[model samples]
Target: MSLTKDGPTPPPATARRGFLDVRDLVVHFFTDDGVVNAVDGLSFSVEPGRTLGIVGESGSGKSVTSLSIMGLNRGRGTKISGEIWLEGQELISASTEEIRALRGSKMAMIFQDPLSAMHPFFSIGAQISEAYRVHNDVSKKAARVRTIELLDRVGIPSPNTRVDDYPHQFSGGMRQRAMIAMALSCDPRLLIADEPTTALDVTVQAQILDLLRDLQKEFNSAIVLITHDLGVIAEATDEVLVMYAGRGVEYGPVKELFAAPEHPYTWGLLQSMTRLDRKDQDRLRPVLGSPPSLIHVPSGCPFHPRCPYDAQAAPASREIRPNLIETTPGHQVACHLEPAERQRIFREEVSPGL
Candidate 1:
């Protein structure tokens, strides 16, 4: 990669893209043991007023991709490549100062844990106002007003009074709401929510999702929501990206993918989720085997070890890595199984249970 003091050299100009477009992104951690390929050649895009859900097991590179986009994957042992474009600008090639300027005002993140993310000493309002002041040329009083407005907008009850409460003072749901308020303090055009509903009760999760939808409608912002909940993906996202072992295995429109998923990995994920509609289901069908080690990922198809249909592809599945190919207009999957065989299995075996 070409580099100067500023940062990595920008790629040549390309055609106009979505509000946020990430292409062939790769993230690796040069640990003492070996290089951990946290993310490998993952690509996705989110347009204004739309949400993209990334679902996968732990250590599946979901969070790494988000951090890479936010420019938080910088350190001694970390390396990131590929393009992260917001609007017409390339981010991976941008300078530290440039990334810093865009972080809050142009793009912001609602982190998974609010308690650890927020300062214990500072009041909720103080933190939000401080973030607002950093980007906007406003007095403290004006910033405070904006904070309250954001808090109220995000459904924080009695925002004017509760704004003074510290992070610990708020419940888990409230803390998440506060985090959302803080993320939107600047009306950022792109929002990255890393497990925004994690740890909250079911009702609270639904409320948070609703709040996000409302906010998206109001601001027309592009959102990247990282979560393991397939239900959340079905309910909130326009598109779903199923990841495994640091790579995207299936990606497509949420409704169609969920209705008739193609990849065996995607089928396993769907089967694993608890279904309230299926009363006959005595137990959840968990995906067999464990995720592979990123440092020494399985050869060929990373998920072949656990894939029930691996025998169908046989030597190819074990010998060569499958490239992500478009099975339909906008849906893609990475697997060795023939499209006809995949559709047959899904139609005969998977759809009945689901």
Candidate 2:
């Protein structure tokens, strides 16, 4: 019993450091039409053992942000600027080989679609072992053994046999689990899950979320969960960042953000979700107007075009850009509307409806 007394202790709740920091992240693609701003001046951070959810509609730069962090945007006629510091290491400045080494060992991503992300031609064991071998100087037999352990850790039944099966041999949920196992194989400190629950059945979705939660506690990994599902964001994240066009419109604690969202774009996202909490609520009413084209994004606030509060907003929303300003401690919103007015609208109109 005395031997257990000296176990490592997690920092006090107030004494956490930013384990992953991304500042002014800008990712642009050169296209026939023009340069498309996939991510525009985005900045956020996640601490070890915490989850930060990046939520938005399709093309809101959620996946692009994750890809940029992983350096998957390299050599694609893409221009990426900004500093992605993972555990104080400047990733943007790191050499290609340096980043490649860190890809699985320090940072890993669970992609949205494992079917497409995994190699169908190879067996799961080979793929997993190859990933392990890339960062470890282990024999193939040792790698295969480690791969089976990972499969077992991620809850695969009869993992020894499943390890030899191809990607197509695994079901949708199994594939998703395998993806998680691969991401965890190297015990990465940072895990980026881009729509980890996409295209799964409702039950399987819940299972995946639970799996991530359990694994996160075990590994104490900093996670950036990218998803359009607000429900998943609410249940999974410690903080939330709402992206519009390509920029962050709202960022704050999940509870406070969900209860008192300041940005109009965030309001639309919340109002549109089909909440089982309110059975009598009518059918879902999605945000009006499609997301603006990134190449032709509106001047000033990118959300101003579809913004219901545009008429009520100040000149900034119409003619000048609004910077991300902190209205409350750790709560930031980039909107031209005055903080008091935004609060009043959410409190009087938005909060009551949903």
Task: Report the poorest 10 consecutive residues by lDDT, candidate 2.
Answer: 1-10
Off by over 4 Å in 1: 1-14
- Pairs of residues clashing in candidate 1: none
Give candidate 1's root-mean-square deviation (CA, Å): 4.4
Cα lDDT tens digits for candidate 2, 267-342:
9998899878866746666789999899988998888888888989846787877777788878889898999999
Each model's lDDT:
0.88, 0.87
Say which candidate scores most in TM-score.
1
Residue 336 CA error for candidate 1 (Å)?
0.8
In terms of lDDT, the best-performing candidate is: 1
Question: Candidate 2, clashing residue pairs?
Answer: none
* Cα TM-score of candidate 1: 0.95
Model 1: per-residue lDDT, tens digit, 1-354? Answer: 011011133334554566798877889999999999999888788899989999999999999999999999877899998888898888999998999999998999998888888999999999999999999999999999999999999888999999999999999899999999999999999999999888788999999999999999999999999999998999999998899988888888898799879999889888889877876735678889999999999898999999999999989999888877788778888889999889999999988877
